[model samples]
Target: MLMAGCAHFAGRHPLLGYTEKDHPQADTALVVCAEQEQYICGITGVNQVATWEKFNGGKTPWVRVLPGKQVIKLTLSNSHQLNRQQVTIDDVQAGHVYRIDVGFNATLLTASYTDLGKMDAYTIHMPRFPLSPKAITASF
Candidate 1:
């Protein structure tokens, strides 16, 4: 039953990469969510983001964003509970790649990013709490 539900969701939202018809412009930056084994991390939204079909193509997890400041909404799950977070990039530059890593340690959730341009990293720690099943479902 679980597999069937996942298949249904995947059919509705197929992952794709950048293509000529749906590729990012030269003046935009790319942001990707780093997959971790201890937790599940995903990019739920981007700034003024349309559907996930626009930025992600070719089966990639990265999304394109305009230069300057951008806000990315993310969801982190550890099977039992789910948490939502927003990470802001103050100076996103064009033609550069950025990666956001979500980590779970005890009751804390940490989000970090490294700008590929400077290779500098920053981390944001958020308190994690268990949510009721109804609350988790409502997040969708």
Candidate 2:
């Protein structure tokens, strides 16, 4: 598995396929699967859909995609179950960063997105699954 620590150093080489080496930061949009405690989330596929051999079992936290409408596949998991969810973001702007947030809302496993680049923050609800309270609580 590939692991990326939250650190950076001068002259350090970038991770091939994981860094912005190929996808320039100024023209590509980034989808970040922020680490969470309530559940585990990972980016599985970006538009142009590559093979699972590069998925690293969803351990990679972020992916770069061309600006415009893009479909992202993700793996979401809690203590009781695992699921794959596909989210479509329309009119994705270049040089902007978007984040996928997954959480349990007492009744369902919820996913949403936020445009971090904007000041007027808003959340777009994505796929959701009905999971019982017992199942969610068991994780604790």
Candidate 3:
């Protein structure tokens, strides 16, 4: 079931200098196409305005309104921690609206944020991939 709200991110930052190979779980994560879906996969406690780490535990997908002018920071966890991972986007201008899509498990999530603070978070549960429709070949 897709939870209809802003949810938290899970796991640690690909384990430092991690690559696609390092991420055994990457395959388990929903496959996302940039054109079909828009999202940013970030780690919590990694990128914070206060600190300088870029990869931490947890995941946060945030939309930037007026990026590079007035930025907003977001963090997530796997129901264990809260905003522990500090991922910060700096110099986000104040005006332009952005839609960020995050891929996790069988769900595609989103978060709306700005200089003010968190606005809302929602989830779009994804259906099984390699769609059954596409699996069928056209006979015509």
lDDT of each: 0.54, 0.55, 0.27
**In candidate 1, what are the lDDT values of residues 1-140, reduced to their tens digit?**
66434323331322222233454355566676654556666666666553243222211245666677888777666767677777899998876667888777778676778786622222222212242211111000
- lDDT string for model 2 (1-140, tens) is 12222121110211222333556555665676655766877667776564232324444456656677888777888897677776788987765667889877676566778876722222222222242211110000
- Deviation from native of the Cα of residue 73 in model 1, angstroms: 0.5
Clashing pairs in 1: 16-57, 16-58, 16-59, 17-57, 17-58, 17-59
* lDDT comparing candidate 3 with the true structure: 0.27
- Highest TM-score among the candidates is held by which one? 2
- TM-score of each prediction: 0.58, 0.62, 0.22
Candidate 3, 1-140: lDDT as tens digits:
23311121212121221223443331212111121233434432222232223222223222212233323343432332333212234554322223332334444243333333222322223222333211211110
Q: Which stretches of candidate 2 lie over 4 Å from their true place?
A: 1-23, 51-56, 105-108, 118-140
Q: Decide which is better by TM-score, 1 or 3.
A: 1
Between prediction 2 and prediction 3, the one with superior TM-score is: 2
Stretches of candidate 3 off by over 4 Å are 1-60, 84-86, 92-140
The candidate, 1 or 2, that scores higher on lDDT is 2
lDDT of 1 at 123: 27
